[model samples]
Target: MARNPARRAALVDAAIEVLAHEGARGLTFRAVDAQAAVPAGTASNYFADRDDLLNQAGRHIHVRLAPEESALAELMDAPRSRELVYRLMRDLVARMLGDRAGYLALLELRLEATRRPALRAALTRTLRENLKRNVDFHREAGLPDDGDTVLRLYFSITGLLVEYLTAPGVLDEHELDDLVGILVDSALGIGPHHR
Candidate 1:
Protein backbone atom coordinates (compact mmCIF):
# COMPACT_ATOMS: atom_id res chain seq x y z
CA MET A 1 0.00 0.00 0.00
CA ALA A 2 1.47 3.32 -1.02
CA ARG A 3 0.97 6.37 1.21
CA ASN A 4 0.53 8.78 -1.69
CA PRO A 5 -3.16 9.62 -1.92
CA ALA A 6 -3.01 11.30 -5.33
CA ARG A 7 -1.05 8.45 -6.89
CA ARG A 8 -3.34 5.89 -5.37
CA ALA A 9 -6.37 7.73 -6.72
CA ALA A 10 -4.80 7.94 -10.13
CA LEU A 11 -4.07 4.23 -10.16
CA VAL A 12 -7.62 3.39 -9.13
CA ASP A 13 -9.02 5.68 -11.82
CA ALA A 14 -6.80 4.04 -14.37
CA ALA A 15 -7.96 0.67 -13.15
CA ILE A 16 -11.55 1.81 -13.78
CA GLU A 17 -10.73 2.69 -17.36
CA VAL A 18 -9.00 -0.64 -17.84
CA LEU A 19 -11.90 -2.52 -16.37
CA ALA A 20 -14.34 -0.60 -18.53
CA HIS A 21 -12.57 -1.30 -21.79
CA GLU A 22 -10.76 -4.56 -21.07
CA GLY A 23 -13.02 -6.33 -18.61
CA ALA A 24 -11.87 -7.98 -15.36
CA ARG A 25 -9.48 -10.39 -16.97
CA GLY A 26 -7.66 -7.57 -18.69
CA LEU A 27 -7.18 -5.63 -15.46
CA THR A 28 -3.65 -6.01 -14.09
CA PHE A 29 -1.05 -3.97 -12.32
CA ARG A 30 0.92 -3.50 -15.50
CA ALA A 31 -2.18 -2.61 -17.42
CA VAL A 32 -3.19 -0.02 -14.83
CA ASP A 33 0.30 1.39 -14.76
CA ALA A 34 0.24 1.74 -18.51
CA GLN A 35 -3.19 3.27 -18.38
CA ALA A 36 -2.03 5.69 -15.75
CA ALA A 37 1.16 6.35 -17.70
CA VAL A 38 3.22 5.62 -14.65
CA PRO A 39 6.16 3.35 -14.02
CA ALA A 40 5.52 -0.35 -14.51
CA GLY A 41 5.45 -1.20 -10.77
CA THR A 42 3.53 1.85 -9.57
CA ALA A 43 0.12 0.24 -9.44
CA SER A 44 1.35 -2.78 -7.51
CA ASN A 45 2.60 -0.39 -4.84
CA TYR A 46 -0.87 1.15 -4.46
CA PHE A 47 -2.93 -2.04 -4.46
CA ALA A 48 -2.40 -5.24 -2.50
CA ASP A 49 -3.64 -7.44 -5.35
CA ARG A 50 -6.04 -7.64 -8.24
CA ASP A 51 -8.94 -7.94 -5.83
CA ASP A 52 -7.91 -4.79 -4.06
CA LEU A 53 -7.74 -2.94 -7.35
CA LEU A 54 -11.10 -4.31 -8.38
CA ASN A 55 -12.77 -3.26 -5.16
CA GLN A 56 -11.28 0.21 -5.29
CA ALA A 57 -12.31 0.59 -8.91
CA GLY A 58 -15.87 -0.32 -7.99
CA ARG A 59 -15.97 2.28 -5.23
CA HIS A 60 -14.38 4.92 -7.40
CA ILE A 61 -16.93 4.42 -10.15
CA HIS A 62 -19.78 5.06 -7.70
CA VAL A 63 -18.12 8.22 -6.52
CA ARG A 64 -17.72 9.28 -10.10
CA LEU A 65 -21.32 8.50 -10.96
CA ALA A 66 -22.91 10.20 -7.94
CA PRO A 67 -24.93 13.30 -8.68
CA GLU A 68 -23.31 16.66 -8.10
CA GLU A 69 -24.23 18.44 -4.89
CA SER A 70 -25.27 21.57 -6.75
CA ALA A 71 -27.64 19.57 -8.87
CA LEU A 72 -29.15 17.86 -5.86
CA ALA A 73 -29.59 21.17 -4.07
CA GLU A 74 -31.25 22.68 -7.10
CA LEU A 75 -33.58 19.75 -7.30
CA MET A 76 -34.49 20.04 -3.63
CA ASP A 77 -35.20 23.71 -3.95
CA ALA A 78 -37.71 23.15 -6.73
CA PRO A 79 -41.35 22.33 -6.02
CA ARG A 80 -41.79 18.62 -5.47
CA SER A 81 -44.15 17.17 -8.03
CA ARG A 82 -44.46 14.54 -10.72
CA GLU A 83 -42.83 16.96 -13.14
CA LEU A 84 -39.90 17.30 -10.79
CA VAL A 85 -39.59 13.55 -10.62
CA TYR A 86 -39.59 13.40 -14.39
CA ARG A 87 -36.86 16.02 -14.54
CA LEU A 88 -34.83 14.13 -11.95
CA MET A 89 -35.13 10.92 -13.92
CA ARG A 90 -34.14 12.70 -17.10
CA ASP A 91 -31.13 14.18 -15.37
CA LEU A 92 -30.20 10.76 -14.07
CA VAL A 93 -30.17 9.38 -17.56
CA ALA A 94 -28.11 12.29 -18.82
CA ARG A 95 -25.62 11.96 -16.02
CA MET A 96 -25.15 8.24 -16.57
CA LEU A 97 -24.88 8.70 -20.30
CA GLY A 98 -22.38 11.53 -19.84
CA ASP A 99 -20.04 9.16 -18.06
CA ARG A 100 -20.38 6.05 -20.12
CA ALA A 101 -17.01 4.74 -19.03
CA GLY A 102 -17.85 4.96 -15.35
CA TYR A 103 -21.17 3.17 -15.80
CA LEU A 104 -19.52 0.54 -17.98
CA ALA A 105 -16.89 0.03 -15.31
CA LEU A 106 -19.67 -0.43 -12.78
CA LEU A 107 -21.30 -3.01 -15.04
CA GLU A 108 -17.99 -4.82 -15.32
CA LEU A 109 -17.67 -4.77 -11.54
CA ARG A 110 -21.11 -6.33 -11.30
CA LEU A 111 -20.06 -9.19 -13.56
CA GLU A 112 -16.81 -9.74 -11.69
CA ALA A 113 -18.63 -9.71 -8.38
CA THR A 114 -20.44 -12.93 -9.26
CA ARG A 115 -17.20 -14.88 -9.09
CA ARG A 116 -15.56 -13.13 -6.13
CA PRO A 117 -17.36 -13.28 -2.82
CA ALA A 118 -15.43 -10.44 -1.25
CA LEU A 119 -16.06 -8.18 -4.21
CA ARG A 120 -19.69 -9.22 -4.28
CA ALA A 121 -20.17 -8.34 -0.64
CA ALA A 122 -18.40 -5.05 -1.03
CA LEU A 123 -20.30 -4.04 -4.16
CA THR A 124 -23.62 -5.15 -2.66
CA ARG A 125 -23.04 -3.04 0.41
CA THR A 126 -22.02 -0.01 -1.61
CA LEU A 127 -25.00 -0.25 -3.99
CA ARG A 128 -27.48 -0.83 -1.16
CA GLU A 129 -26.15 2.15 0.73
CA ASN A 130 -26.45 4.30 -2.37
CA LEU A 131 -30.00 3.12 -2.93
CA LYS A 132 -30.90 3.88 0.65
CA ARG A 133 -29.49 7.37 0.34
CA ASN A 134 -31.53 8.03 -2.79
CA VAL A 135 -34.70 6.71 -1.15
CA ASP A 136 -34.09 8.86 1.87
CA PHE A 137 -33.48 11.90 -0.25
CA HIS A 138 -36.67 11.35 -2.18
CA ARG A 139 -38.70 11.08 1.04
CA GLU A 140 -37.01 13.98 2.82
CA ALA A 141 -37.51 16.28 -0.13
CA GLY A 142 -41.27 15.73 0.14
CA LEU A 143 -41.44 14.20 -3.27
CA PRO A 144 -44.81 13.05 -4.52
CA ASP A 145 -43.77 9.41 -4.76
CA ASP A 146 -42.84 6.94 -2.03
CA GLY A 147 -39.69 4.90 -1.64
CA ASP A 148 -41.24 2.08 -3.64
CA THR A 149 -41.63 4.42 -6.59
CA VAL A 150 -38.02 5.45 -6.23
CA LEU A 151 -36.93 1.82 -6.12
CA ARG A 152 -38.93 0.98 -9.21
CA LEU A 153 -37.52 3.98 -11.05
CA TYR A 154 -34.07 2.88 -10.06
CA PHE A 155 -34.58 -0.55 -11.62
CA SER A 156 -36.19 0.83 -14.74
CA ILE A 157 -33.47 3.41 -15.27
CA THR A 158 -30.77 0.82 -14.68
CA GLY A 159 -32.24 -1.50 -17.29
CA LEU A 160 -32.53 1.38 -19.72
CA LEU A 161 -28.95 2.39 -19.13
CA VAL A 162 -27.66 -1.14 -19.60
CA GLU A 163 -29.55 -1.57 -22.82
CA TYR A 164 -28.49 1.82 -24.13
CA LEU A 165 -24.86 1.39 -23.23
CA THR A 166 -24.21 -2.25 -24.11
CA ALA A 167 -26.51 -2.45 -27.09
CA PRO A 168 -26.70 1.04 -28.43
CA GLY A 169 -28.80 0.41 -31.51
CA VAL A 170 -31.43 -1.51 -29.59
CA LEU A 171 -32.93 1.64 -28.07
CA ASP A 172 -34.14 4.47 -30.22
CA GLU A 173 -32.36 7.64 -29.14
CA HIS A 174 -35.22 9.87 -30.18
CA GLU A 175 -37.67 8.04 -27.93
CA LEU A 176 -35.51 7.97 -24.82
CA ASP A 177 -37.12 11.01 -23.24
CA ASP A 178 -40.58 9.60 -23.85
CA LEU A 179 -39.52 6.27 -22.38
CA VAL A 180 -38.22 7.94 -19.24
CA GLY A 181 -41.46 9.87 -18.93
CA ILE A 182 -43.41 6.64 -19.15
CA LEU A 183 -41.25 5.02 -16.49
CA VAL A 184 -41.80 7.95 -14.15
CA ASP A 185 -45.53 8.04 -14.82
CA SER A 186 -45.90 4.30 -14.30
CA ALA A 187 -43.86 4.33 -11.09
CA LEU A 188 -45.88 7.22 -9.71
CA GLY A 189 -49.14 5.57 -10.83
CA ILE A 190 -50.10 8.60 -12.89
CA GLY A 191 -52.64 7.22 -15.32
CA PRO A 192 -55.52 8.63 -17.33
CA HIS A 193 -57.60 8.67 -14.14
CA HIS A 194 -54.88 10.29 -12.00
CA ARG A 195 -52.56 13.22 -12.44
Candidate 2:
Protein backbone atom coordinates (compact mmCIF):
# COMPACT_ATOMS: atom_id res chain seq x y z
CA MET A 1 0.00 0.00 0.00
CA ALA A 2 3.01 2.22 0.31
CA ARG A 3 3.07 4.63 -2.63
CA ASN A 4 6.72 5.61 -2.10
CA PRO A 5 9.57 3.54 -0.81
CA ALA A 6 10.97 6.42 1.21
CA ARG A 7 7.63 7.06 2.85
CA ARG A 8 7.32 3.41 3.78
CA ALA A 9 10.85 3.44 5.15
CA ALA A 10 10.03 6.47 7.26
CA LEU A 11 6.95 4.73 8.61
CA VAL A 12 8.98 1.64 9.43
CA ASP A 13 11.62 3.70 11.18
CA ALA A 14 8.92 5.43 13.19
CA ALA A 15 7.46 2.06 14.06
CA ILE A 16 10.85 0.95 15.38
CA GLU A 17 11.10 3.99 17.62
CA VAL A 18 7.61 3.39 18.92
CA LEU A 19 8.32 -0.27 19.51
CA ALA A 20 11.56 0.53 21.30
CA HIS A 21 10.07 3.18 23.57
CA GLU A 22 6.43 2.10 23.96
CA GLY A 23 6.74 -1.70 23.59
CA ALA A 24 4.69 -3.78 21.16
CA ARG A 25 1.37 -3.17 22.92
CA GLY A 26 1.73 0.57 22.47
CA LEU A 27 2.42 0.32 18.75
CA THR A 28 -0.60 1.62 16.90
CA PHE A 29 -1.06 3.38 13.60
CA ARG A 30 -1.76 6.56 15.48
CA ALA A 31 1.38 6.15 17.53
CA VAL A 32 3.53 5.52 14.45
CA ASP A 33 1.97 8.47 12.67
CA ALA A 34 2.64 10.67 15.64
CA GLN A 35 6.18 9.39 15.98
CA ALA A 36 6.73 10.04 12.31
CA ALA A 37 5.17 13.50 12.64
CA VAL A 38 2.92 12.60 9.73
CA PRO A 39 -0.77 13.24 9.33
CA ALA A 40 -3.12 11.05 11.31
CA GLY A 41 -3.75 7.70 9.62
CA THR A 42 -0.66 8.11 7.53
CA ALA A 43 0.86 4.88 8.75
CA SER A 44 -2.23 2.92 7.81
CA ASN A 45 -1.75 4.04 4.23
CA TYR A 46 1.71 2.43 4.17
CA PHE A 47 0.80 -0.73 6.05
CA ALA A 48 -2.23 -2.94 5.79
CA ASP A 49 -2.28 -3.70 9.50
CA ARG A 50 -0.25 -3.66 12.69
CA ASP A 51 1.40 -6.96 11.74
CA ASP A 52 2.52 -5.52 8.45
CA LEU A 53 4.02 -2.54 10.26
CA LEU A 54 5.77 -4.75 12.77
CA ASN A 55 7.18 -7.02 10.08
CA GLN A 56 8.35 -4.05 8.06
CA ALA A 57 9.96 -2.61 11.16
CA GLY A 58 11.87 -5.86 11.65
CA ARG A 59 13.17 -5.74 8.10
CA HIS A 60 14.06 -2.09 8.55
CA ILE A 61 16.13 -2.81 11.64
CA HIS A 62 18.06 -5.53 9.84
CA VAL A 63 18.62 -3.33 6.83
CA ARG A 64 19.79 -0.40 8.92
CA LEU A 65 22.11 -2.54 11.00
CA ALA A 66 23.55 -4.60 8.17
CA PRO A 67 27.14 -3.79 7.48
CA GLU A 68 27.98 -1.88 4.33
CA GLU A 69 29.04 -4.02 1.38
CA SER A 70 32.24 -2.05 0.97
CA ALA A 71 33.21 -2.62 4.56
CA LEU A 72 32.58 -6.34 4.22
CA ALA A 73 34.54 -6.44 1.00
CA GLU A 74 37.44 -4.72 2.67
CA LEU A 75 37.42 -7.28 5.43
CA MET A 76 37.19 -10.06 2.94
CA ASP A 77 40.22 -8.73 1.14
CA ALA A 78 42.24 -8.23 4.28
CA PRO A 79 44.57 -10.93 5.45
CA ARG A 80 42.72 -13.50 7.47
CA SER A 81 44.07 -13.75 10.99
CA ARG A 82 43.09 -13.74 14.62
CA GLU A 83 43.59 -10.02 14.55
CA LEU A 84 41.02 -9.69 11.78
CA VAL A 85 38.61 -11.88 13.71
CA TYR A 86 38.95 -9.66 16.74
CA ARG A 87 38.33 -6.61 14.59
CA LEU A 88 35.20 -8.18 13.14
CA MET A 89 33.87 -8.93 16.60
CA ARG A 90 34.73 -5.44 17.75
CA ASP A 91 32.86 -4.02 14.78
CA LEU A 92 29.76 -6.02 15.66
CA VAL A 93 29.80 -4.72 19.23
CA ALA A 94 30.29 -1.17 18.00
CA ARG A 95 27.37 -1.51 15.61
CA MET A 96 25.15 -2.82 18.38
CA LEU A 97 26.12 0.08 20.60
CA GLY A 98 25.80 2.53 17.73
CA ASP A 99 22.11 1.73 17.20
CA ARG A 100 20.82 0.77 20.63
CA ALA A 101 17.27 1.75 19.73
CA GLY A 102 17.07 -0.44 16.66
CA TYR A 103 18.54 -3.38 18.55
CA LEU A 104 16.05 -2.90 21.40
CA ALA A 105 13.22 -2.77 18.91
CA LEU A 106 14.55 -5.97 17.41
CA LEU A 107 14.31 -7.58 20.85
CA GLU A 108 10.77 -6.29 21.16
CA LEU A 109 9.97 -7.83 17.82
CA ARG A 110 11.26 -11.18 19.06
CA LEU A 111 8.94 -11.01 22.06
CA GLU A 112 6.00 -10.07 19.89
CA ALA A 113 6.83 -12.92 17.55
CA THR A 114 6.18 -15.38 20.38
CA ARG A 115 2.44 -14.70 20.14
CA ARG A 116 2.17 -14.05 16.40
CA PRO A 117 2.64 -17.12 14.26
CA ALA A 118 2.97 -15.19 11.05
CA LEU A 119 5.57 -12.87 12.49
CA ARG A 120 7.41 -15.82 13.97
CA ALA A 121 7.61 -17.57 10.61
CA ALA A 122 8.90 -14.48 8.87
CA LEU A 123 11.40 -13.65 11.60
CA THR A 124 12.63 -17.21 11.74
CA ARG A 125 13.24 -17.27 8.02
CA THR A 126 15.08 -13.96 8.20
CA LEU A 127 17.24 -15.10 11.07
CA ARG A 128 18.02 -18.38 9.35
CA GLU A 129 19.13 -16.61 6.23
CA ASN A 130 21.28 -14.25 8.26
CA LEU A 131 22.98 -17.18 9.98
CA LYS A 132 23.58 -18.96 6.71
CA ARG A 133 25.06 -15.84 5.22
CA ASN A 134 27.24 -15.34 8.27
CA VAL A 135 28.49 -18.89 8.03
CA ASP A 136 29.28 -18.46 4.37
CA PHE A 137 31.08 -15.21 5.07
CA HIS A 138 33.18 -16.80 7.76
CA ARG A 139 34.17 -19.62 5.44
CA GLU A 140 35.08 -17.18 2.71
CA ALA A 141 37.08 -15.13 5.16
CA GLY A 142 39.04 -18.19 6.28
CA LEU A 143 37.64 -18.05 9.79
CA PRO A 144 36.13 -20.89 11.78
CA ASP A 145 33.55 -22.59 9.52
CA ASP A 146 32.49 -25.80 11.24
CA GLY A 147 28.79 -25.86 12.05
CA ASP A 148 29.15 -26.20 15.80
CA THR A 149 31.96 -23.70 15.94
CA VAL A 150 30.05 -21.12 13.94
CA LEU A 151 26.90 -21.60 15.99
CA ARG A 152 28.71 -21.36 19.30
CA LEU A 153 30.49 -18.23 18.15
CA TYR A 154 27.22 -16.79 16.91
CA PHE A 155 25.26 -17.51 20.10
CA SER A 156 28.07 -16.47 22.40
CA ILE A 157 28.57 -13.13 20.68
CA THR A 158 24.82 -12.64 20.44
CA GLY A 159 24.37 -13.20 24.16
CA LEU A 160 27.19 -10.87 24.99
CA LEU A 161 25.79 -8.17 22.76
CA VAL A 162 22.27 -8.51 24.13
CA GLU A 163 23.51 -8.24 27.70
CA TYR A 164 25.75 -5.30 26.88
CA LEU A 165 23.00 -3.40 25.13
CA THR A 166 20.21 -4.14 27.60
CA ALA A 167 22.30 -3.34 30.66
CA PRO A 168 24.90 -0.69 30.11
CA GLY A 169 28.12 -0.79 32.20
CA VAL A 170 27.78 -4.52 32.70
CA LEU A 171 31.02 -4.75 30.69
CA ASP A 172 33.38 -2.08 29.56
CA GLU A 173 35.06 -1.96 26.14
CA HIS A 174 38.26 -3.49 27.52
CA GLU A 175 36.33 -6.27 29.16
CA LEU A 176 34.48 -6.81 25.91
CA ASP A 177 37.82 -7.23 24.17
CA ASP A 178 38.84 -9.81 26.71
CA LEU A 179 35.59 -11.64 26.22
CA VAL A 180 35.87 -11.49 22.46
CA GLY A 181 39.44 -12.67 22.74
CA ILE A 182 38.37 -15.62 24.84
CA LEU A 183 35.59 -16.51 22.39
CA VAL A 184 37.77 -16.16 19.34
CA ASP A 185 40.64 -18.01 20.98
CA SER A 186 38.36 -20.79 22.10
CA ALA A 187 36.76 -21.11 18.68
CA LEU A 188 40.18 -21.22 17.00
CA GLY A 189 41.66 -23.41 19.72
CA ILE A 190 44.41 -20.90 20.31
CA GLY A 191 46.07 -19.90 23.55
CA PRO A 192 45.07 -16.90 25.67
CA HIS A 193 48.11 -14.86 24.68
CA HIS A 194 47.73 -15.52 20.95
CA ARG A 195 46.67 -12.54 18.88
TM-score winner: 1
Tens-digit lDDT track for model 1 on 46-86? 88999999999988998989889999779767788998998
Weakest ten-residue segment in model 2 by summed lDDT: 140-149
Q: Each candidate: RMSD to true structure? A: 1.6, 1.8
**Scored by CA lDDT, what does every candidate get?**
0.89, 0.84
Provide backbone clash counts, one per model. Answer: 0, 0
lDDT of 2: 0.84
* Candidate 2 stretches greater than 4 Å from native: 172-174
